[model samples]
Target: MAKIEQVLESIGAMRQGRTGRFSRGVRRGLYGIFDLTAMTAVLALVVLIYIRFYGEWVIDHRADALQAASSAVIEDRTGTAVWRASLPEGGYREVASAAEIPLLVKQAFIGTEDRRYALHEGIDYTGIVRAAAVNVRSGGTAEGGSSITQQLARNVYLTLDQTWMRKLNEASIALALERHYVKDEILTMYLNEIYMGRGQYGIKAASRRYFGTAELNRLELWQIAILAGIPKAPSAYNPVDDPERAAGRAKVVLGLMAEQGVITAAEADAAAVRAAAYEAPQQSVVDAAGTAAYAAAALREAARKTGLPEEQLRGGGYRIETGLDAAAQAALTGVFAEDAYFPPDMGGQQTEAAMVVVDHRDGEVRALAGGRNGDGAGLNRAVDMKRQPGSAFKPIIAYGPALESGRFSPDSVLPDVLQTYGGYSPRNVGGVYRGSLTMTEALTRSINSPAVWLLNQTGISQAIEFAARLGIELGSEDEHLAIALGGLHEGVSPLQLAQAYSVIANGGTFRSAHFVRSVTDAQGQEIYRFDPEAESRPAMSAWTSAALAFMLRNAVAEGTGQAARIPNRIVGGKTGTVALAMKEVSQAANRDVWFAGFTPEWTAAVWMGFDRTDSGHYLTVPGSAAAGLFSAAMGKMLAGR
Candidate 1:
């Protein structure tokens, strides 16, 4: 009985030991699962953090990022892209189709860079572990395990920052790309996006630059391998700089292709042999493409009107539909760019000119130009520089206000003798004023004395207020009576003057000057649009505007603005010329000449002057030069229509 008890106890002990073993195994399995769950949660949290902060940068620049293929285009009134600019990469690049990319090149890139590209979803964990191990062994950055998509994310969205945070951000963006695009699209974008040496930004551009031909399908296996290996380290393995290194990199690519079963050992050997004997040719310098003045102004105005930054507009793959009449702009630019416009007798100086033409019916800027020979964006005087308008403001300040206040008429007689207002005495051109002339005659001849008298009669504040209602920006220093004579603290731009005159032409309604008609994205989705008929602010009474227009017609017919006469169409305008009083003969005197005019169809302003402040030469001629340019430009424009 005691032996039986001992056997029972031993059996019980054995059972207990087995139960203990089973519990420990269950705990071990549970711990393993817990560890995996913890790791996954940590990864998820990291991804969430990335999405919360860094992911927005990728979204903001996604349009530019995708524009790796094409540039932003500025279109003309005909809805045709008139000018193009690649703001990010600084030049044009082509997007490659999968068929245009050689099968061998694809194989070489995939084999050498990311062997598991077809298996992983943007990030390869196995490759990451391997790279981490290698980096730990080397005590520094010994290997990069980024996939092609990850490289694209880094290239497009993120800067090359060697930080763990940047890597995390890259992984997050790569995941976003995978979610957005399919595998083939991602691969094609990557292959086309990687920047190669030389001003080239993509594989196709690099191929054209290095091979001197855009035909990539015709490249030899060795050439394909060379081009494929360049995106890894473009400068280090540039074929032109170090042919041997480039060949060495190509051999590695070939070996990887063989290992990946893309090519046989024999094929790889042949490519290797060809690479050793290959010689890289020198690259030629390519000049940057030029942008027209009207297109440049339209681009800037598009940015301003839409509140999009210029950089964003440049790379956002935007199709800016501008109001620029291409033919009109071309004619306007040609007229101002001519050397004959700046005659030797008129100062023998280098003269710069700016002009803006707006449709009187809608206030849409039809044509605009700045410098004669610049790239059109440099110093846009048409909308940037403000010069005194001289007598151009007289009609706005004196005559328009006088008519609106019912205190003056076109036939009302005013003394045109020398006049003084608070130590400021104003005179007509050459100090020769008609003794007494009607309001219409005074304005037609731009007689300054009578204009000052009219300003006193209308009250300077009322005149300035009236001008302000017409979109003329005046300052505190503009309170002086000289404002009646077009002397302001800060003068006006051609665009501003054109817009102000457009008010008179549009029957006393104010319309802000705008260049872009509509803006569309690359997908042809309308992003922003300006309806010219939306402007409804009233500047003056229609009767006053008509009275002013009638007088201006007289000016263009037989008075100071006679040079602006157009035979076919009834023209009305005001001429202004301001001479800078400097003390130097060679650098003493310069004139800012202006003509603000309109037909029933368009209101335009022309300005001519030197870019610098101290030009010694002054214009000896009357304001006829500016008026003549206006007439020529308007004639060409109307004839084209």
Candidate 2:
């Protein structure tokens, strides 16, 4: 019995040990689970912090800054601003928000783009997660739950580059926005800031193009949907070009509206009907001609300064008066189409020409014709192409120095003969020496030997200094002896010469040359305006310029420029011809011909040359007729002025 009790005690002790072991195992398992749960909660908090603070805070501000900069625009003098582009790398304009935006249009845009806009700071993660889950199940970005603030953040500050870094930045900026501004204010800003296509930027411009009014409700739901898709691809989904694609995108917008409860299925169907009833609008031929790609290009360039998209500029409803004179434009364009002495029989290509007309009074550009009939016919030879000015540069070398030195005047006589200065020998045209011609007579005749002799008297550096002050951009590496003969290692543009001549025509005050004026953004903010920089130095004195003018007049009256003479007009001008300047050392290729001229009211220059491979031939006539085109175009283009 005692042995049995001992056995029972042993059995009971073993059972108790087993129970302790089991309890210890259970406790270990519970501790492991608690640690895991704590770690998971901490991770979730970290993710939430990133989404709430980094994604929402810092990144949102960057978006606003980039968007604000990209959305600003400069305006035309007519006050009509164009903006179809929101961002620009190499484009022309920059634009901003409308200063005079209609209040009703703002309300409509807010209602359409973000209904819960003013309530949330920026992102709504619950909605975003739901959209994400749906997106994963089906390959669609069809559901976007971003509030107006978040959308603005993405559009303005962030690039569309889908990198992990970019995603983090977007979230940070969105959160920052929530911490900073009130919801209503953000809504207003987003409505004014986002891009709508077709040079229409804001809701107001969109309303004008799609609905023909600034009021929003008047638009068919389809039109509204179409407008909504413009931010995605303005050029691709344009209704005028791809109606089917536009309609298809409209359905997607309608689907989103239904999902958001902004519209019902029944309402969406009715809106589709209203949209189908819409007939595409047609532009009047008159309006269409004036609103061409060229005008569009200029407006885009002007608009780029505003920082707004091109769409906003077209419908901004302000007059865009230009310095362009209609009569001058017509006359200048005709010159390119004028019969070319070159053959049409040479394989059916039309001769191309380019010209720029300027107002001598203030250096305002009157016209720039790129080609015949404004068709971009000629290589833009007027402004961009740089060719040797030939003898046309002689005025600066020969005439300018003479005036400044007080050693020679219009009436001062200089001996004209084959002259050697330093190691260089220069001869007059045709190598025929004419002795003792006055400054006026020498300039009219464009005598090279007399010019060289004058250089010996006055010094070449003095001539170059005069040229540089007048905006020639001539460098100091040149031999001053070359100044007498107008030989340089480089060339210049005719348009540049025209600008320089305008100063002399206007009593010697240099005005900056300009093609663009001002820019405004979608919100009507004047973002950039181009004004002439103040003159830091004088180009010349009026008395000296007047004396030079007296000499240039003799050029047309008695020299090689007699072909450019205009009856009943008091004109002053110069002619240039250089055998070496127009050819290679072998004299195989003729490079260029030039004529720079001015009347009492206008100044102009002309250059004709082959840029492909130098043509190895010279036009004895253009040195005659290039200058004549101005006299002819002047009668037609500037008849009134």
Candidate 3:
């Protein structure tokens, strides 16, 4: 019995040992299989990431996609493209090569935008992790981990969406850029591709726009810091828009440079001081003669005529041919730029002025100035602003229509006394009434009562029709005797007034006032052409136009417009002044002053006033102020003719 029990125990122990050995072998085999599968999956992920980093699409389309769009060229009458239009990105970009980029500019940008730009490959995994951790802690995106190459990739190839897909794409493209281009080349492209503010792209364009120079090497360290800071938030840090904010941002950039050892602490402190004191160059990037207004107007006209959007007109590489006589435009610009040509500042606000010159022979806008000191793209007052013509409207709405009626002649006598039409009393300027005066004398003296009387006699409907024939459209609201004194519901623009006077200058023919003469596409195919004949029509009889011209010539020669007389030219003009809204304001404190005048070859309208018409901002000068400016500008234009 003992032998049998021992044998059984030994058998059970042997079976238990065999079962444990089998179980251990199966567990080891399963662990080995799981390890192999995990290793294979990781290897596949690495291979996929490598392939994405070296994307064929990114490499193939890089050159073409990165190429900047060509700017549309706006040419003057001489076919010289004096200006280049803004690109689709709302600015002008002038690409600069690595050689053109200065060392300080590069250092400033790298220090401020990407401190680890030199050390990072395309994707900064450590930075991403750090930024992600911070964002997670804050529950918001408070920091960016993108390097310079990533920014370039996003600017050139991706939208600014915060989706994971966009991030993936940006990372892939950035990796591709790093793989293909050297560090210096990538930095150069990044500098040339970034947008700084105020319709400017690239450091070169920003330099030219803000500092008034395209020479990057000449930029001060403060200016370089300004350029560096602009890319983070362009609109917020634009020096032209907000100098204090821009200086603050620039100080931060300078500090970054100091921290990076690119600049010493003392150097950074000096740059910060200069940055605080910096002012945008008053001189525009446009020619010193200031063809910016003309170029802007020409671009607008090109867009209207070609049925293309202004953006397409700007960057489609179209050639816009304008009627801008360079000499005439320069003459107008020069007159506006001169402080002496305008009234002294009132209430610490300088007077603003606009002028438009048209060639009556073809109704081409020869020259224009939108404001006293413009940077080429703001409010183009000549074409955009409409102000009361005052006495300047007498010829268009009253005298011209009266003459065409055959009921009045230059010598016809009319009363210049205070008169009322339906409780609307029209008084002569200064309330002095000449009981009766010849039509020529009334016009020459710019008597308001006679103009109202003449319009009453001509009939408001007839006068409106006649004015329209001369390219001065009046609405139903303007069907009142007050229109004779330029009191229309909607006043006329400088361009409109110039066009109306052009009919008299050209002996009764009216042609549409236009700036763009023609436009050609990138392939030089004519897309638009202004046909003067198509826009031509007889606004009045030659006899009436001649009589009116004779009277206006007399006005310029001996009457209120005497200041507009140009020697050796058959100058004809009318002086106009709109009173301020407040009756308490002195008569001399006018809201607008104008001189609409013409020579045999050219017709022009000059307007000067404050943009606002409050008592503190009213013009203290008379119409003669604009007349004198007209004389100076016209003399310059006629000199070369």
Candidate 4:
């Protein structure tokens, strides 16, 4: 009865309010101490009761199960890791270490949710007493307390079973941990064991996930304190979630750190400033593809050298060493963006184009364009799109073979009248023949009737084989004779067609085009090497190719490609037209216009057309427009460096 009275008297004293020197339960000496000892004994008895109820029945079993769960997760990398995808956002992704947390972002966590983490062994007895005293003083239970060790015990071993049994189990686990590990060690374990924000189960991961990058040994004062602040409801203070709240909490941590001499007041002030004004970063700018936006496609093609995964190549931290001369790329983008080439009508929608530069010896692709809008599509249509080579493919089948036959060199006479062979009658642009003309004259003029004459004399099979050797893959030789006018069977990709033209320019040696230079795996092991083809074929002897080259020279001199002429540099190429095969006139009659040409050191091809096949969008004219684009692309590519 006296023990109950003492408890009531202490509660009543607390009810009135007290934090200083003894102002509660005034009494005489012997009875006062006896009452104190009695209260102490009761507290011990409560601890013992909690330990007994929880210690053996629940804690021991749970600890064993948790250990097993940890073991099972030991090798499951996903469960151990945190970051999984390569995001467009700029930063390295981090994963958790042994703890199911992101290691770099988070550090040791405090059971900061508990108000009395440090002063108690596993549970806060004094806080429990004070809170009970206050609660009784007010009318009912008001506050409770838990130590770091107790919180860890609950998190690791006991589910949130609100029953007394669960509380008893938590108490036993706390006791076991306290007995097994020293107080500091128990605190350390608790710090390492708690969960933080962003799906991170530990502090380290949380730290790295939010702060960009963090290293334990190198974390700044703010970084460490920022981590310290995150253990208490990470979402509530996540900078991305609630920047203001997070900053406020972090300031509190900074204050604690300063008080503890972890950092200075000055340091905290600077960190506060940095946090308040943050700048998002752009992806690192590289210098290699400097000027040649036209070379972007070529660079993309060159990605084959790294053996990088295609996704990574297109979007990863890839440094592509393209054959693109930046000056060349920029020049093309600039010129195409001007008033010369695009249609004057809302400007040329078809002005968007593709260009490729191929090295003749072993066909190394030097440059390309997916469109006039370089890098917009991020794809090189020169290699990836199959479009007609137009009259451009004519030199390989009709002109080159006839020149090499000795029976018909450039000077040989050929009739220019429209001729019907195999139900195919080839005509001139306006159906007007120049009567008769020499082979060189015929080619210089790009006259269709004479080209048919040459093809008939050489046979379509021979012509097909000739084009095949030049890298033009014709579907059938037995088709129409109209192809002598440069009509193709199945057509060819700009890349392949570029190489075919390159073969003639490079003395008949065909280098297979390649993009990838070398490739190393994720582990940095070399996995592939591209072999540049070194052999030359008999497609045409140097003499015949040289003669054909000479004849096409007039194209830029005074012929159809006079617009493409560059002063003093000898260039040879042909123009092509996709002939508006669509309905609803895009422009006038021009379908697609193209120019595939070569210099001694560089072979470049350019194609201009509407994005779609609609006649209303393509060139209404024949080959003049493609020639203008070709001239501009080559001018830029060969300009400076």
Collision pairs in model 1: 586-616, 587-616, 588-616
Tens-digit lDDT track for model 3 on 353-414?
A: 99999999998888888998755678989999999989999999999999999999999999
Residues 359-401 of candidate 1 have per-residue lDDT tens digits of: 9777788887776674674888888889999898888888999
* All candidates: TM-score: 0.66, 0.67, 0.69, 0.58
Which RMSD does model 1 reach against the true structure?
10.9
Candidate 1 CA-lDDT value: 0.80
Cα RMSD, model 4: 14.2
Global lDDT scores for all candidate models: 0.80, 0.61, 0.86, 0.61
The alpha-carbon lDDT assigned to residue 146 of candidate 4 equals: 56
Residue range with the least summed lDDT across 10 consecutive positions in model 4: 68-77
Model 3 misplaced regions, further than 4 Å:
1-68, 90-155, 158-288
Off by over 4 Å in 4: 1-322, 344-352, 375-380, 534-539, 581-588, 614-618
Best of the candidates, TM-score: 3
Candidate 3 contains a number of clashing pairs equal to: 1
lDDT of 2 by residue, 1-641 (tens): 99999999999999999999999999998998998999999987887777766754454444435343332322223443322223344222223244434443344345555656555556677677877998878898866666677776776677878787776667667667667766655655565556665655555555555555545556656677776756566676656556677777667667777776667899878766665555565641122221222344455455555565555554442223334544455456656556752212212334444566667665556666654545432355566666667678877766777788887788888897776666777766556987788878787777777777777677777877777766777776665677555577666666787877776776777776544555443444655555556532367888888887877787888787877777788777776555534434444323455677888777887665444423333443446656676667765665655
lDDT string for model 4 (136-209, tens) is 89897554455667777887776866797677767777777776667655654554455655544444334545
